[model samples]
Target: MSKPTLTDLNAFKAVAEQRSFRRAADLMGVSRSSLSHTVRTLERRLGTRLLHRTTRSVSLTESGERLLQRLGPLLGELDTLLEEASSHEGKLTGRLRINGSEAAIRLLLQRVVPQFLALHDAVELDLVAEGRLVDIVEQGFDAGVRLREAVPKDMIAIPIGGDLRFLAVASPGYLKGKPILETPGQLALHRCIRQRLPSGKLYRWEFQKHDQEVLADVPGAMTLDSSQLMVEAAADGLGIAYVPESYAHAYLREGKLVTVLEDWCPHIPGLHLYYPNNRHVPPSLRAFIDLLRE
Candidate 1:
């Protein structure tokens, strides 16, 4: 019998699991054509067809089904062993890709990432800031940040920051002419700034008071996709902006902005560092999590 390559197995596994070459390629961070070629190469080596592919659908053949059933647990075990081995190694090295919102990255990159990189110079950090949620595994990211421990149970979640609150702030000029909004509904009467998600959808402003929880889809004079830009616009008295209170503090104190509707914006759980529960967490991610914990 001829020996098989690890790449062959990995490619085959991805194709079988996702049932589509395009999706498999997405998960592996390779082009669809490259993934298709890799799978064909594996098929040639085996001298048998493993997947039945049509224009619209792909399915595993009988042989492919048997192979997947056996390889799934084996691959899982290997991943665990790899993480365990790296944990006990003298020097750890690998690239760690983290997906998160722009605001959270800004809050952590300066103080947290530099410290981790200094200790683990062998590791490389890839931080991607996006507004919409994505399938991290399919996007070739090692981990993602969620607003709290609200991520999927299949992922291991570590709370990176403590409680956080959204601050509604505006320039003194803007507020001078507007009536103070006693309720979220009154926000409709005031000009507001809005942000868009990566999915090209606007983020709905969430508010709570007593037993009345309101999600306002308020119209805005200007629509933006960045928190920094939103804050800057609000500082110029364009409208009120909902921003993380932590980032709003400096501007509020420096007279660049004034916070309002403090009682409406209550503190909640902060950002969470999360990754697949059974994934082979590279050394860089493990170290970064530890640093975040400290």
Candidate 2:
């Protein structure tokens, strides 16, 4: 019997771990049919059925499970060793996948991304802007960007931006006839725009003054999942919107939106870049982190 090549082993491993040919193909950047063919060739060489595939799912055979148990750690170590060697060469070259929030993406696009790419032409950064928090490892991301408070305790986190605050604002037209909001409690009487969180729950408007904090369940005629949309809705006289100050900056400057209950808005910890605490830091990731710090 001919020996299975590394490519064949890798294809099998990806399929076994992902348990779905389509998902494995996406991660390997290959066509689903090609990946399936490679796995079949591998199975023939081994003279055993490695996977049981049906219309909806795939499962590994007993022999396949044993092979996975033996090969998974070895492959992980090999990848790490290769990454370490690449780091010693002093040239960063590889893909760096980052899952980030929309606010974080805005910060990167402002200057960080362009500068980093210009400096390291060999590195490719794949950034996905996600509104909802996700498990970076399960999602196959090297790192993720989120507010400091949102980062998991098991992850190593580094601040990437300064403190941020939310602003409650509305278009002049919307507020013209409504009573002015004097406190967070008075927001109940106003038509507010609310944001829907990734968990499918409405975000409660948070406020603070001195040592007192209040979470207001402000009612709204409109609810949106995007901060940009909230700002736009407020600017179009739909309702009052509580959004990140940066998102509403342009509209506020243009006199499209006016602030209300400014004293109640609380400053919060800013965005942070977080990654698994127990993994070997890839050279590409390390280089990007250094660049971000600089």
Candidate 3:
């Protein structure tokens, strides 16, 4: 049997890691059928079945599991060395995948992304924006961006921007006759646009002023997941919305939405870009982080 080519081995690893030909092909920028053929050719050369495939599932055979156990670390080391060599030559070339909330990603596009891309022309930065938080390492992302408080304790997190505050605001039409909301407790008297968290739980609005802090399960007639949508709903006079101030800034400036509990909302640690602390940082990711720090 001929030796397996590095490309074939890597292709197989991608399929094994993702457990779906479609996902692996998407990540590798190849057709699923082509990727399947490549993995099959590798298995044929090795004279052992690497995967068990069914209509809806894929699983590694014993031989495939053993090969992956040994190959994962070796390929990681190889990637690190390659990145280091490229960096030493004053060129950073690799793909950096980042998982983040839509709001966090919007901030990056506004401030950091343009500068980073200009400096590292060879690097491919893949930004995946979603409402849900994901396990960056397990999902094969190079890093993740989220609110600083949401980052896992085990990860190395660096703040992406200055502090942020969540403001409780409503359209002027909606608040015209409602009594002034002096405290978070008064939210009970108003209809709030409830925020549904990624984990399928309703978000309890948090407030802090001086030494007092409160978490209120604010009453609502409508629930939404995205902050942008929440702001839009508030602007439409659906109800009061508690969202990041940035999301509602345009409406606030246009005299559509007005802050209700300004004193209750306090600045908190803002969005952060985080990566696994135990792994070697890829050169592309390191460069991006350095740019953020600047």
In terms of lDDT, which candidate is strongest? 3
- Given candidate 2, what's the lDDT at residue 22? 98
C-alpha lDDT of residue 242 in model 3: 94
Tens-digit per-residue lDDT, 10-30, candidate 3? 998999899999999998999
* Residues 1-294 of candidate 2: C-alpha lDDT, one tens digit per residue: 999998999899889878999989998899999999999999999999999999999999999999988887676667667767776787777678899998897888785888889888878788889788888875557899999999999999988878999999999999998997888989889898989999999999889999999999998877899999999989999999999999999999999999999999988999999999988788778878998888
RMSD of 3: 1.9
TM-score of 3: 0.92
What TM-score, over all chains together, does every model reach?
Answer: 0.75, 0.88, 0.92
lDDT of each: 0.81, 0.88, 0.91
The TM-score of predicted model 1 comes to 0.75
Q: Per-residue lDDT of 112-183 in model 1, one digit per residue for the tens?
A: 988887887767678888777877775557789878745777888888777898888988989996888777
Per-model tally of clashing residue pairs: 0, 0, 0
Task: Please give the lDDT score at residue 158 for candidate 3.
Answer: 94
Show pairs that collide, candidate 2: none
Q: After superposition, how far is residue 192 of candidate 3 from its true place, in Å?
A: 1.2
- What's the distance in Å from true for residue 17, model 2? 5.7
In model 3, residue pairs whose N, Cα or C atoms come closer than 3 Å (at least 3 residues apart or on different chains), thus clashing, are none
Q: Sorted by lDDT, highest first, which candidate order results?
A: 3, 2, 1
